[model samples]
Target: MNTDTIVAVATPAGKGGVAVVRLSGSEALAVAMGHLTASRLQPRKATFCRFTDTAGQLVDEVLATWFPAPHSYTGEEMVEISCHGSPYVQQEVVAELIASGARLAEPGEFTLRAFANGKLDLSQAEAVADLIDSATPAQHRLAVSQLRGGYANELKRLRQQLLDLTSLLELELDFSQEDVEFADRCTMLDTVAQLQSRVQSLLGSFSTGNALKQGVPVAILGRANAGKSTLLNALLGDDRAIVSPIAGTTRDTIEETMTIDGITFRFIDTAGLSQSDDELEALGFARSIKAAQQATILLFVRSVTIPFNAYATDDIAYFTDQCDMSSKHLFIVHNKCDLPHESNPPGHIVSAKEGLGIDSLKASMVAAMRKDASANDGVLLTNLRHRSALQRVQEALLHVAEGLGQQMPTDLVAVDLRDAIYHLGTITGDVTNDELLGNIFSRFCVGK
Candidate 1:
């Protein structure tokens, strides 16, 4: 636990209607009271007071609140001073506290103390940073879910089951000479299989979780003069891309982001995919293919003015050969429906010029991404660190299952079980190191 008192400007930089200066640790209240005109402060109650420096010069009128030890954010005595949001005023108040002996806090130090004091676990602490950085509703919901302990609780339950299994195996090892087995081998194998399945399910959720946490990438791809840029603008509800009737107008990918129904989608309007004689146009073609390969969803736009049956099959085949479309969610968007076209066009028909069928297209995109995420109680794994740890746990469980199937020695099986438990423990800080803690918390902003 940290022993020294720390102080910082808790709110964001720059002037607002109000600014907060936070102080924590053993000397927090004392350091704050030293400059306050108030004779005394009641715990957890806000008291309006006048603040002054050592020379007894007034600084600002502030509302001071004291949070006594063990009930505060860091589980230590804490003080929060709310004052007018003047940068100079915030600086003067902090300087006064520092002069009175409270050091400026390091990045994430306050939350680090909270973790050390058992106010929150490792995952929850990480969630605090996520919540602060959340830009969209989906990200906010995910961070909130983890912060509320649902994710932690589930992990803890799995770890407890593994610990129980390990205990039984350890017991069997101790009684090896007596030729007794505390655990039924058949039941043990089933348990290990079940655990591995659950871990694998979580590992599978990483792709969707990461996409939602970050915006989902959608690449708009088609041949030259196919109205791909028009579709991009329609989806974004803005003229984000330059629309031109000339061939190869867009020579590079133009990327933009828009939030639809609380989900953020990064739309990439790529240069048309076609055989180009010019070097720069050829380079654009290459980039367009790369964008298509990277995107989670692909919008293959085609103008309705063109004969659909004449070029549809050949174009689709060419694009399929150029990029891997097996993993991507593809939509053959027949754009310019407002123009004269055939009665039965293949795939989705839309008029980007008139804004027709764009809403349905967006709905389909969201549906495709949300389909896999709607399962497993919606407990998506968004952290790469957690995914990596769960992967190791999965591997360890696999080794345990293999050893039991091969009738390996009890001691060897026990070792693998312990390995699985350790990795699982790392996720929630049941097992952690100073280096890991420092790395995770350092990313947090100071005063948090």
Candidate 2:
């Protein structure tokens, strides 16, 4: 396709070590040559140049590099101008390119063009955004692996197997009138089972993948003056929430996502749980209960010296009387071991003020979530879009298999199989719509 040339400030704006202006499309080299004064240009080779306007106005001295089509990042003729990192210089360069017929690129338009030109598959393209937005080291590592063909290779192999099975079945259909047996029924059944198992394994990964992508929600719950806020600051290694000796200090939930040993955790500091008849305080307590329910893990903070409360000791009665039993994913934490206060006897002893037991608590939390991650290992259904698409494909495949087992008309089975194939193709852009593409790529940052 003869796409129009596009240009943009490829490097981050403002003063830096170096600024890069990228041009891609049919006229990339022409635009570069017109603006940049280079003695001779060689593919993949850097050249010293003096950029100038058409009116022979001096622009700036810079480094120019060109990459030919089918060998470039976007699989198009590409040029990169490395100039001094100054906003004025960058703006001047972009203006010169725009004046020379290259249009300013939109957010992710470069990558979008790459996809349209068949330079990258849909999954690898998505991984580009994931790589940029990664919050933790582990996340960045995983995204990099996926982008470099870890996940893509796996999906490709599975899809190829499914395609081969479908091809064999379709071939068998050709001699249906002659009562010929081209493919064995046992083989077909075994293949279906294998694909189903693979899909299920991927489905199991959604929980951990989601948790890894979006940090796990953990709510801290305890009575007023129970050192809940203090505990939060200790765990975060910073004072995020205001701490005071007064009761009902925290009015609303304070949320922060922090990583401890590569695992990301979203700690929610709920209003101190207490017996308050005040309508607003009652509402805060109610919100705490709600958090306890929504949370995957609950940190029930209390003083180490004080005896257990009715809610903590009478576990069955607490479940029966106040909070939902299913909602309580309980972890009893004894905060303020160094202070003189009433609290449950040191279960997992801690003094948030002294930063004691913080490491053990973190280790315990990691162990619990690690158990969750390991239980459903290797089968990571990370993308919700992929999961839903696969689910629909699974249903269509089941319909085809059921129709085959019933010995229905071959046309019916064939139609179901084609529909399933189409559904599967959507994962890699074979069957996709503009709206879906737009909604996805729009979330990407402009410089991407």
Candidate 3:
């Protein structure tokens, strides 16, 4: 545990109704009391008081609460002061605390301390940042679940199972010459297979879980003046993108996010792809093609004004072929449906100008996401770090399985099993280094 006390303004900067300044560590209570005019500070109880500077000049009236070591946020002595939310007042209070020996906290230092004090595991510590940064309801729910031991609990169980197997394999090596097999070879193979399946399943859910945590990317593609921007404006119910009758008006991709049915979609309206002589427009066209390929869903917009034959060009064919529609959602949309049209085709027809079929388009997008998202499953693996670790676990188990199939030496099998166990321990933080902890916690806000 760190011996030096830390202080920072807990709330956002600027004037508001109230601001909270927090201190944590060995001398947190003493530092807070230095500026507070109160006879006694009680633990977990709010006490009204006056805050004063070193010269004995009153700074502001405030409420102070104290939490002693082993019970506070950092599992150390802590103090929180709430006062009028003026930038000047907050700064003055923090400055006074610094003079009283509390140092300003580094970004994420508070939460880092919490992790060191055994208040949370590495995965749970990362979730604290996720919960703070969540922009949508779905994200909030996912983060909350993670913070409340969502995948961490599962990871612990899985790690223990692997540890047990490694122990048995290592024990078998002790009686190698005697040929006394404590662990049955056939049953051991079966148990390893089951654990491998579970690890693979979690790895498979990474794409969908990550998309939910970070908004899903949807690329909008079409030719010049094909109503791509118009469709974007209509879907967002605002003039978010520039729409014009002129061709090649949108020379670059314009991205925006909107939540529908609690699912957030990042719509990237790329420059219209067509034969363009302009250098900038041509570069943008290349970007459009790349964006379409990477998107989770491709929204292909076509103005009814353009004949169907126009979409049959080589560029369109190349784009469609490059996109794996089987794995990705593809929405073929016919825009400007307000005009008279022919018989209904398989694709959705919409009038961006009149907002026709926009609702159904949104509904389709949500339905596609819902089909992919695992809602009620035990835990979704959202973090790429966890996914990579699981992948390593899978690779090591594969080696172990191969060795078992070949009837390899017991020591060789034990080596692979220990490798698998080491990788699994990294996920729940049973095995970690300072560098990994620093990288994860550095993204958090100061005074977390």
Best by lDDT: 1
- Please provide, for model 1 over 307-364, each residue's C-alpha lDDT reduced to its tens digit, 9 standing for 90 to 100: 8787866877766676666546788999888988877455788999899999999998
Pitting candidate 1 against candidate 3, the one with the higher TM-score is 1
Q: Residue 66 in candidate 2 has what lDDT? A: 95
Predicted model with the maximum TM-score: 1
- The TM-scores, one per candidate, come to 0.93, 0.85, 0.88
- Please identify which of the two predictions, 1 or 2, would achieve the higher lDDT against the true structure: 1
Clash pairs, model 1 backbone? none
Give per-model CA RMSD. Answer: 2.2, 3.7, 3.0
**Residue 392 miss distance in model 2 (angstroms):** 2.7
Q: Which has the better lDDT: candidate 1, or candidate 3?
A: 1
lDDT of 3 by residue, 1-448 (tens): 4669999988887899999999998899988998899988998999999999999999999999999889988888999999899999999999999999999998889888888888988888888999999989879877887888557777877888988888887788777788878888899899999999888878876767787888888998988888999999998999999988889989889999999989898999999976769999989988998888878888888877666665535545667887766547878888888887665457888899999999999999998877776542647888888888889999999999999888898899888988898888777677899888888888988878
Q: Give the range of the ten consecutive residues with the poorest summed lDDT in model 2.
A: 315-324
Sequence-dependent TM-score of model 2: 0.85
Tell me the TM-score of model 1.
0.93
CA deviation > 4 Å runs, candidate 3: 54-56, 223-225, 240-251, 272-282, 303-317, 324-327, 375-378
State the displacement of the C-alpha of residue 303, model 2, in Å, after optimal TM-score superposition: 4.4
